[model samples]
Target: MYAAGLLNYSEHPMKVIIDTDAGVDDAVALFLALAAHKDPKCPFEIIGITCVLGNTGVDNVCRNVFTVLDSTGVSNIPVFRGADTPLVQPFIRGESPFFGVDGFGGVHSLPNIPVVKQERTLEKESAPLALVRLAREFQGELTVVALGPCTNLGIAINIDPNFVKNVKELYIMGGNSHGVGNIRPCVEFNFFVDPESAFVVLSAAWNQKIVMVPLETCKLAMSSMEWRKQVLGTIKSSCSISLKKGLLQRFEKDYGSWCSCDAVCMAVLLKPSIISKSSTNYCTVELQGAHTRGQVVVDHPQKTGKPHNVTIIEQIQLAELERMLLSTFHPSTFI
Candidate 1:
């Protein structure tokens, strides 16, 4: 079921750029991406990271990125700031943030974490422009892992139609596959924040491959409460320490399970072999409806007669997902 064209043994190192909102789960996923690169033979070679507004403001997002960099002892990757608002409307969070106002699980903005101004790691160029430039520069070999709203990428495509045309793959952790919603009824948080951008990005005519790890799949990837407290809580690295202290603040205990949605999506992408089921569908975001404004309108069963545009991960191995996430914290634990 893992036949969505991402595997290539000859292509040892896959070039990647992460677009995120720096949520707690995003932090976990970001660290996972960073730590995987520590392995000299790992397939992912992250080119850069782009920040957007989702879990918190873009400024806080930048600060959180720097915090992750500080924890990981990584400095080479450049970070870029992107759209603060959506394409057609402002992003109304509509509720209090689950990952705290700063999206670091309310470490209460621990003083040890370096501010963006202190490290000055953010690039002068904006994220949308950087995205377009990178896609053109990479010339069809760049994989974009978007862990937030599709605003930045949508803006990039609008700036240059060929931006999507030049990209190799896009892995997004957003939307609901079966009308199951997290933030609102029939809507997921990311797509709900920016439905217009979601509509644009998902509906656009693109030659590049798009793989979505939906909220549904992420739910299936959740770890049991025992596993979270015993296995994940026991790891003692900078990343793991951060995870226990701040990253899992509010989300650590939810329905007797730990659901790191973005990290689940990252694990699926990092180890595609864990994908036990997948489907090809023409998916689009609902732009207008009283109750279903941001719902992902996946055309199931060829009802639309449209060519399948995106590959949606339907099922995954929960045990394998745990292994990948555990390795992200303690690199040598798995192998």
Candidate 2:
């Protein structure tokens, strides 16, 4: 049974900006965002998408972002390519053998949507400058859904210490509280890949809201064959077909469950009450550990007596998740 509290945010949707790396999971998250945008009850509007480097190269991620948008028949969402690598470090290629050469599991066939060149003027602006401009323009109304390394966000905060105060909140898909890491035994991929950026963002003094979806919570929200079939069944456009085929093939090959880690993050932004959250006394990123570099060190026991900097999601209701997904897939049946 779904918890009553989990269904709380159905009354209103939030304005959001998705910063992603365009992984398969990221694609799922994007779909959830689009679905929310389509819902009349949900007032969420995806202002734009900012691409980063993590699951794949910046170019591949940019392509995947546009491809996913095209497949969903969504246009007019401007995408900006952020930093090509982490702040102050060279780009180290990850083991894509797990996620396919291209982040979307090597889905070759794509929609015939014209490859719209990125708005060069937007590209010319530094990521920090662009973020500041956007925040100022949408002051106190934009929520940033960060689904990858926090490089651009950190830079933005550094550029303008008041940057966080100007926005609504930041929904981040990263960190691991239980010591289980996807990239390393103790380090989650997103934090490990760019500890510096993560540190800067997390430590910033932001009155803006913060919701963190850790690995522990995300692992429990795994995808199954039934879910994949449901998602594929909803495809009526050629772009959707290409994405569905590629996604299915990847899952069949034993790559990974099309887990919606990023999607869950987006879901929380749309409906914050869907998951149970806990307040950590304080949290810091481990950057120099021998085997635990990039691990999110939460002060669970309040040993430091420091003020809380982030709101960590410790548990989520599965029934509520299923309900949300079903409603997103079939909007008319939701009411």
Predicted model with the maximum TM-score: 1
Q: Model 1, 24-74: lDDT tens per residue?
A: 879888877876665555666888999999999999998888877767777
Which runs in model 2 stand beyond 4 Å of their true positions?
A: 1-9, 95-97, 108-126, 226-258, 327-335
Residues 1-335, candidate 2: write the lDDT tens digits. Answer: 22212333556556678888887778767866776665555667888788888888777888888776665556666778787788866657756544566787777454553333333323555555777778888888888889988888988887888788888788899988778797788788888778889988888877643678998888787666666566634534333423455456645555355456787887777777777765654788887888987899888888888788888887776656766655444423212
Candidate 2 lowest-lDDT run of ten:
113-122
Indicate the residue-level lDDT of 125 in model 1: 97
**Error in Å for residue 227 of model 1:** 1.0
Question: Scored by CA lDDT, what does every candidate get?
Answer: 0.80, 0.72
TM-scores for all predictions: 0.90, 0.84
Measured by lDDT, the strongest candidate is 1
